[model samples]
Target: MEEFNLQFSTAEQCLKVIADEKWQEGFECRKCGRTNYCQGKTPYSRRCTTCKTDESATAHTIFHRCRIPITDAFEIAYLVCGSPKMSSYELSRRLETRQMTCWKFKKRIMECIEHGAGLHLFDIPQKSQV
Candidate 1:
């Protein structure tokens, strides 16, 4: 895996990289399948004017719903990408955060990757009674 500069000096840089990856062909309306989306006038985020579908640059990503700072988030991604076999607790230790938070982050990252890999949440098997 390619190593990224673990540090993101500004949130703008993080958003730029995320936007480039998520909206490579420009913003497309998820609801109407139209390429007529534009940045929202409001301070919230972007919106699809054509279909009225709204989205954030962080939508459908591990960074969504995270309260951690952008720099920390980038660090988490870097850690995960670099330490493939490390445990969640190890990650928490490295980040100097709670183990449970790291666990949640790990799970959410897994979910996002699964979604990217075309696996729906419904397709995930439930735990069976032993």
Candidate 2:
């Protein structure tokens, strides 16, 4: 069995990384196409000044609507991107989560990779706000 080398251990750390990637290109409000933003109600979130719509660091990324905690999701994403062959059973043991959950999430990650959207969290193509 291969060793699991997870990159992020805490949700806060993962959120910071996501936030950096999310806003590195500057903020564009999903609604009204405005670039102005303000501090959001939550950390790493951006509130569009024009539309008053708030988006989180994980809003449109692969982490969007993630069922697992951010830390677990990050670990899964890191490991999967690192070695795409690892079975969900193996991931379940490593994460101490349900195997089915791991399988479902792993499938999602694999789909992104299969489509060439990205191999890592930062590389995953975020869905444009519609």
Candidate 3:
């Protein structure tokens, strides 16, 4: 793995990164399948121009269900990815998050990596019947 600085200094920067990754070309509405959307009230979301549906930058990604700030979650994920042996306690102390939250995120990340699961960190899986 390449040593890249994944630490985002601000929530806006983090949201931008997520948005860029999610919509490489441009914003596309998931509901109406249109390429037009308006800036949403939240920094991490957008509203479709056609269907008026809201979309989150973290939607359908590993960070989807996270309660912490997206930037903090990204930081924790980066640390975990870089140092697989680091414990949840250390992570909690470093990130100022709950140990259980750290553990759950780490567990999910490790499981995805170890099992070659479709939900691996970066590779978004295609839709399929389970």
Q: Using lDDT as the measure, which candidate wins?
A: 2
Evaluate model 3: give its TM-score: 0.75
> Cα deviation of 108 in candidate 2 (Å)?
1.0
Q: Count the clashes in each prediction.
A: 0, 0, 0
Candidate 3, residues 21-80, lDDT tens digits: the string is 777777778688998888877786889988888988877666676678766777777788
Which regions of candidate 2 deviate over 4 angstroms?
A: 1-7, 120-130
Instruction: Output the worst ten-in-a-row residue range by lDDT, candidate 2.
Output: 121-130
Backbone clashes in model 3, listed as residue pairs: none
Q: Per-residue lDDT tens digits of candidate 2, residues 1-130?
A: 1333344656878888899877888988877899999989888899999889999888878888787898888778777887989999999999999998888888878878887778544445644211
Ranking of predictions according to lDDT: 2, 3, 1
TM-scores, each model vs. reference = 0.68, 0.85, 0.75
Q: After superposition, how far is residue 36 of candidate 1 from its true place, in Å?
A: 1.3
Give candidate 2's TM-score. 0.85
lDDT of 1 by residue, 1-130 (tens): 2235543666777777766667766776667888776676533357887777778776665566667666566766666655645688887887787777776665655654555532221222222210
Distance (Å) between predicted and true CA of 35, model 3?
2.1
